[model samples]
Target: MASESPEMNRLHPFSAVTTTLNRGIVGLSVPFFLIGVLSSVTDAVDPVWSIYLAPIGLVAGVAYGLTYYYRFEYALTQDTFDLSSGVFSRRSREIPFRRIQNVDVRQGLVQQLLGVAVVTIETAGGGDTEAQLNFVSEDEANRLQREIRRLTAAANGERSATEAETASSDEDEDEEATSNETADLETAATPERHSDPGVSEDERHEQPVDHGEPTRLFELSSRELGLYSFTSFSFAAVGGVLFLLLFANDAIFGLLISMAEPLGGPANLDSASPLEYGVFGIISLVNGLALTYLFSVVYTFLGYYGFQVGRAGEDLVYERGLLQRYSGSIPLEKVQSLTVSDNPLQRQIGYAGLWIETAGYGPDSGGGSQSAIPLARKRRVYGFAERLSGLERPSFRRPTTVARRRYLGRYSIIAGVVVAGAFGLSLVTAVENWWLAAVVFLAVPPAAHLRWVNLGYYVGEDNLVIRSGFWKRRTTVVPYYRLQTVSTRRSIFQRRLGLASLVVDTASSRTFFWATPTIYDLEYEVAREINETTRQRLQSALRERARSSDSEDGDAGVSVAFT
Candidate 1:
């Protein structure tokens, strides 16, 4: 029996409501406000006319939503996933199965309430998502993800088989006539396999592939979550508080004055004792820090609540979030490298995070990378990274001593600039004791030494590990097979100091920015040697991987023939 062909489908009907709210209301909000202001300023138009615009905009929004809903369509064809959508100008896209990298499903608060989800598809080499099916039924979103995965796997298998057969044929042609005769004899003796009569080609290809039961790898406990939140120390929270104070200074000052009335208010501050002044200042500083910490805790909890990670066959599956749920998979085969990262606070508390960097953009990821374990014990995080990359914690080799001098000079310049700026401002303003600002210079030496201590790299048998940064340290492990390029770099100062840096580039999008993995300020000769050795190792690893893949493909082909 022939399998039915897939038909074009539209988004869930509730999508129109979401579209109206997200697009229509947001689009008209500014114009509506402007019209209302115009009516109030000039009596050329009645305020009643401005009121009518609300219903008019709502109707326009609904009409636009219905039109958008009708125009958008998607279908899963035999070879490609097709989409067509337009409001003013028509646009269409066809994405081939083999090119698809990931299919992620996400549901924001509104979509969750409406029982709908957004399906985002990503492909290799793109900086953004390849396709998004906005507002589909939850079940339909899952079905699409499964279907796309199955088709992609089948397509890749067929392509690999074809290439293998071609390579085998070429090898056979290069052999002597005696070997060819033997091969012909073996081929003639082997029995030919026949397909089942009832199974169509489409049905055979569409047969479900078992991904196996998910093995839970990690889960964030409530206690650990709290600790993670507390230690994260988001600067965004502090910035938000500062911004609020900037915009609402009068109201905030009034409240502060009312609260300080018991302390004789701001009016009596001139006559206050030194002890009283110290206490008041301490209380204010503590209150500000506490408020910032509270904001950070709330934000972290909302983003990471109920975080869980599991392995399902060839992919690592993760689900996280409290209000807006997200579920995605990291394809093991596509992973470029693994990064173990921790800030100063996390390092002190013996906790760190594991990040997975892949070949293409990840849904809601930070530059082609996503957190595999947001927060875990240091030992556990290192263990997980080793399990994936087969490398233990490396003893990193520090850079040349001159690198430390370079850092000291760099930090001293920064401190000098800061102090100069403060002193200059004091000279202009009514501020006294401008010389006290030189205290910043005292921190420069320690800061430079700490930076030098944190910067190091280790060249392993099959992986390259580079650790760097003092405030937000990251230890990245890159397998030779995943290496794309290796080069040495030197600045004018580095050249003068006989120093160079080794940069290892990967397919990760993070490399597009200046965040490419680098071993900083090594001896020039050492950097050159390592760069050459790494390139050689990269070639060897590629060849080994190719042989391994061919062996597995041959085994799979044999099993299929026997079946």
Candidate 2:
């Protein structure tokens, strides 16, 4: 029996009343409660004001939400996926099945409680707002994944060995078999097999492919997301202990309060003594430690409300959301590398964050997909990356941190300019005599260098990782295949020094390496090599995909799975 096209699949039943009410309740009810409480406690305004204003707000919210909701629509065809959405305006996005890079299903706290998840579909378009979905059932999410995978496979298998095999097998069984058929099948055998990697003798003998999560797959629960966020010593995964400490101090006790309540006196007071302050300091230290732990627990519950990740068909699905949903999916082929990392404190906690890099997406949308696998089983990282690699040969070889040390020089230079510019401006604006200029010149260089040193990026043959920041450092990874375009850049100064930068642009993003990290002065040698390697890698992938198609004889096996 022929499978139904995706458009014929069930549409999510719409309930205008329920959806409108949900918007009203969420937007208006909260405000009403707050204002009601305020009215009761203080006579800031008339009690009747909130009663009338609250309903008006509720009505407005419902109207706006429903207007937007009604405009949104998504449906799938046999070969292309269509998403049309807008409130006052309309946008119809059509993406071919083969262009889909990944599918992500996510649920936030509210959606989880309501038993709905958001499905984000990513394509090769390279546009912002890459993810799109409001709420879909768990079953629907899986079905979509299987269906899309089937479509891609079909696109890949157009002229596959299966066609020749089936055609030849049919011919052999028929008494009317044409003599020309046997010769054609034999001619096609080699190219057909080459076109599809799974089209060999082993495939002929193997069982049919199954689009189900492996029975042995591991998963995380909502509680685990919260627990891992709290207990996992992946301190660096969240924030630095040093800065967290300072933040904790300022939050709990105001700067003004702390200064005013100092044991002896404020810094301006001559009578203030270190001995007197020491007594209060010990007590404050204990209070700060306890409060910091509490603060983290609160943050965890609020941020990672319904985080979950596990196997989905032939790949991995990671879902997370708080108030709004965010999800990411990594096809086996799209993944470039996998890594596990821990800071010194995190190592002690016996828990580490799972690190993932794909062809181009990253933590900030420029690199490979990133997941802070909170509370990852320490031993599983190796086996997981290896398993995925087995399914899809990585575009590059081993992961390399060669880019790590190289980043510091460029970082230092950028920081030097920014800091020096600020201080230099201060010098020009300062009053005559300009005693502040001396201080400005003295302070800027070291401060900028320290700022640069705070961030680092690592590169591997298969994956590239870049991390930057002082107070809030972020790390991103990009894979080679996901790269849509590659270019080398050189500023006049950098060109003079012979240093060049590489930018790996995906459809929706640009992953930039400004100035070769290793060589302080620009080196054209490194820049040309990176640009050349990127071009070669991209060409090879396209050729392989194209050749595979020709071999398959043009019939793509769209895996329309039975839910």
Candidate 3:
């Protein structure tokens, strides 16, 4: 591969055209669209002038693309990958092999057309500290990522061997030097002697598991995608329709009226009979809904058309997409938490999705949590979560049945406030119907009861499990050592009820709601007990890891999850 070439290499020359075209189209699309709208609505400029702008933009884009192609250069070494790129002020970055956390290969519409892919390198340091080689051949992109993985593994193995050798030499020297010391002193020093100062905590804990070859975990079938299209929420479709209405309402309505003119369309609602207006409204709504649903199905299907997930060595690999394929791998050890989600409707049909939360690559990463299983049965969800988490089926300690009253009370207060306001307004205006408010009040009790039943917390042998959400249920499993903060909160209502909420915070931010995974409506005493136990677990896990690092045997006290 050219990436493996000893000399610094530039991207495929054709990248210049692709990059320029992609950026220019996206950057100038809005302005050009506005110009078109203005030209149609008002004769601001001759139609021929608009045609000239396109060629000018294309020429400028080509020039910029050529400059970028010449300026970009990258080199892959045994220990580091260096990248240099800048049009005016040159900037260079060196990403050490050891710090690389993830490698992703993406082929967008433009890259696909150009027969190239973009390779993104993300490091453990997080944030915008990432490098991208935007125009490598698809094969080279994959090969480059594999090459980096191989080099990183080799470097880690070499480091481990060196540490083991150093530890052995130190043990021998300690045995010789302590020969004259008392037996008790020698025994104490023996334990401390095995602790190699050369090994970092992460290295000591990273004991390789014997998974053998890459194992296929799950793949989304066409049937499954069809099921997901119906079960999965597609809010984007609604947003698209709203965007069309907001930006091109006049053009869209005009087109619709023109199409319906032969059928006695009510273009002027004021001149139409009541029945005609009603028929027109119904047609428009049905058309909008049908369009929205179709758009949603197509968009969702295209995004996850050929999803495949597997375990490759110590990493979890995910590859999906139809028109623009995306491939990424996450080290198993970087997974901070595992989650399973299913809405009430989905749960009824025995469908749920499994997701993993990794450090840095959280909700802001665009895709939210990385999906392990896009769509699966409930049993598969538990099985995959267990395999990924190295934990048996997750179960809660207790359902907050006792807190049903608290939930009902809080919800009743909210419902009452709405009902009272509506009742007051109804006295002055008939449109603010008191009966409508009463109908909403009727649903509050059931909603509160459902929430109470779903809220629970479990203190497992190796993990802390939190379950909540009734309509869209979510179960979060996080290791004790991964916990960054554990706290108890008391709302005024909960405080009055002698109850507190236990919140478990982990390094994974994808567990979004940023409200954290909380166990709500617990007795104050029980909450305190759980909090204390969680803290002890964290300390114990940390100590065990420390002991593992100090042991001469590689597997002495290794955490099962990391292994």
Candidate 4:
């Protein structure tokens, strides 16, 4: 029998109340609480009204949330997914499967407690194209994500097969047979539409997909994790340690005031020598720094206790976190950039950090999607990068002597201005000693020289490598085709110096600024050459990928798991 036509379905029934409460807490509760606090402190509103404001606001929020939930509906069609939502202003969207770039399942503390998750659908075009189904059961959300992946893969497979057949008439019969087989497979894989209106589309079909055991690449041991924490050097941990050292003693002494008066009293070191006091202060400072480092180490260990990364099919799967237990996968093809970096201490210890930046996975997504390898050796970093991008390391081109001179002049001018200003202010206000500023300004030339020497970029056959930084060095490798834009930019200063910066932008939002991959302080001609080379390389990569894809489609079997 033919399955009933797919129809729009409501989220889990409990989602209404759970969502209402969640919304109330996020949107209304805070405002109401603040208003109540303000009202009690001031005469803006009657005290009696303030007392009822929270309950009233909560009720209104629930009412609005329920109405919004009732209006929202989602349906899966053969070619596209449809979403209809909005209470006052109705909004409807039909997103083609081809446009969908990523489907993510996210669960927060509240969602975890309620056993529900939010499934976000990120498309090639962001903003309005992005669709979210919130407050679905965890099981339902996973099922929905899998279904979307399956449908999208099937669609892509068919399209690729058609393109292959069009390109080669000799494979038309084989292509036709593949199409029939794919249709049969899709039909067999997709479960019939659930008859019960109460059952969500996802909940109706939750069959698991079995792939071979994942090949483990890296796993953090307890000892390695401990070492990682020690090197993490988190500012938050240092600040926390400082806070405890400064303020915690007061509370402890306050509790035992009568017994601790003598011990808490100010020290009378007048009888002691200045050398003794100096030694004591130095020891105390060392202890404080050690305590802070220990705290940072502990935090790192907890954060990455069970970190493990592996390759499963065409995806890189990583699971970590002791308390949160986060597990995420990044499609190898979606990865836009990979960075291997190290601080001075980490470098000395022969360790580097790895970060994989992918499209549609911004830092705002709780940092779950961005692949971060906390600590690894240089070889391991390159190995992971090679597996993910299928590109080897490229030799970098260092900055020219003229560029170094330009950097020196630029840094000296800026440093001189700041130092002169500080010195003048100190002399006028009778504050700090002026000689300090002069001493700092003297180091500007070497600082600039080091920066220029450290800065370098390489445009390779299939990848671009950018090396930068002094204190914490980083080498970012970006695939040619991943680049979205390549341009030569010049500031007024750069123009005067006959120098320009080459900015390579990609779809990965994880980069510091609009996904920028920059090579700075190059001669104008060199910058333009680099930009042109990047453009040509990108075009070549695209054509190569197209040809490779066509050839893959003509092959007997192609795993569309990541497509």
**Off by more than 4 A, model 4:** 1-14, 20-82, 86-90, 108-115, 127-129, 166-217, 233-303, 310-314, 360-369, 490-499, 510-515, 523-525, 553-563
Look at candidate 4 and tell me the lDDT of residue 88.
86
lDDT, candidate 4, 325-430, per-residue tens = 4555555546668877777778888778787776664422332235467887666566555544545556779866777888778787888887889878987895
The global C-alpha lDDT for each of the candidates, from Candidate 1 onward, is 0.73, 0.50, 0.70, 0.65
- Which number leads on TM-score? 1
Per-residue lDDT of 1-563 in model 2, one digit per residue for the tens? 01334343322443344567787877777667778888889998666776678888888879967876776666677677777776667787777775667776666666667766667777544544464666767678767777776565454334243544445433223212211222232233334334543222532332212334422233455655655666633233345445655666544545433644645434432455665455446656655565556666665555555665554443455655566565555554455444445443444544455655544334323444466465554444333433333212223221122333344455556656766666677678743543333444455455555444544443344444444443333333444445666667777756655556565554332345222122122246755776677677666645655554444432111110100
* Residues 408-456 of candidate 1: C-alpha lDDT, one tens digit per residue: 9998899889888888999899778878888989998899899999998
RMSD to the native, candidate 3? 10.2
The alpha-carbon lDDT assigned to residue 212 of candidate 2 equals 48
Instruction: Please give the range of 10 consecutive residues that has the lowest summed lDDT in model 2.
Output: 554-563
Predicted candidate 3 versus true structure: per-residue lDDT over 1-21, tens digit per residue: 245546887887677767777
Cα distance off (Å), candidate 3, residue 195: 42
In model 3, the worst 10-residue window by lDDT is 177-186
Q: Which ranges in model 3 have alpha carbons more than 4 Å from their true place? A: 1-5, 19-64, 124-129, 159-213, 247-268, 272-291, 362-368, 424-432, 511-514, 550-563
Using all chains and alpha carbons, the TM-scores for the candidates as numbered come to 0.79, 0.52, 0.78, 0.70
Q: Choose 1 or 2, whichever is better by lDDT.
A: 1
- Deviating ranges (above 4 Å) for candidate 2: 1-15, 22-75, 82-95, 126-133, 150-209, 214-314, 319-328, 334-368, 372-563
Cα deviation of 213 in candidate 1 (Å)? 4.5
